[model samples]
Target: MMTGLHLVIARNNYVKKLMGLSIFQVSVIMLYVSMGKVHGGTAPVYVMGENGEPDLGVVYSSPVPHVLMLTAIVVGVATMALGLAIVVRIKETYGTIEDDEVIEKDRQEEEALADR
Candidate 1:
């Protein structure tokens, strides 16, 4: 019985570790996107030429990365929302939020069912 409980606890801890890793990965991706926005050039708009014609020396900032980041943000939010919902369901079904507790409860329930 003790061995069975230990196994359950170990499995739960592994799951929690995996979830934490996923959160870390998301944070890193967000950081990368944010760091890509900094620019040292002037705006891509024309002010005036030497003879008042038009100034074409101004550099336009790239909007491609920003647009991609917006898409990534939306996708990340949706993924996080879905993951949270699944976590909520797991908690409700197991009657505990801690990974080990949930696994232990599940093991006990399974044992009870098998004894019948």
Candidate 2:
């Protein structure tokens, strides 16, 4: 995650920023999945006691985090696709995906317009 954050901020290429964002997102998902797992945990099946109440001594892990991560994975894919699409549009408009170059071009265009 730290590496991704560094790349996202330090890189000048728009594609590298997207790649860093993807890495950070994957690391977060992995962290959540690992946290949801227990050492000796089993599936979340409940056992019934003789008194008809659910047994409370089970060491089953909750499925909520895993389920939520599944949704997150889907959303992450969609987000990546959208980011790539935007980058494509930026490249089309600016003819370069380098952040510095794009900004320089915009500034130059502004200067030219000002002189006119």
Best by lDDT, which number? 2
Off by over 4 Å in 1: 1-26, 34-61
The lDDT values for all models are 0.62, 0.88
Clashes, model 2: 0
TM-score of each: 0.53, 0.81
Per-residue CA lDDT of candidate 2, range 1-116, in tens? 99889989999999999999999989998899878865455565766768886656665566988899999999999999999999999999999999999999999999999999
Off by over 4 Å in 2: 39-43, 46-59
| Residue 1 displacement (Å), model 2 | 1.4
lDDT (Cα, 0-100) at 97 in candidate 1: 68
lDDT of 1: 0.62
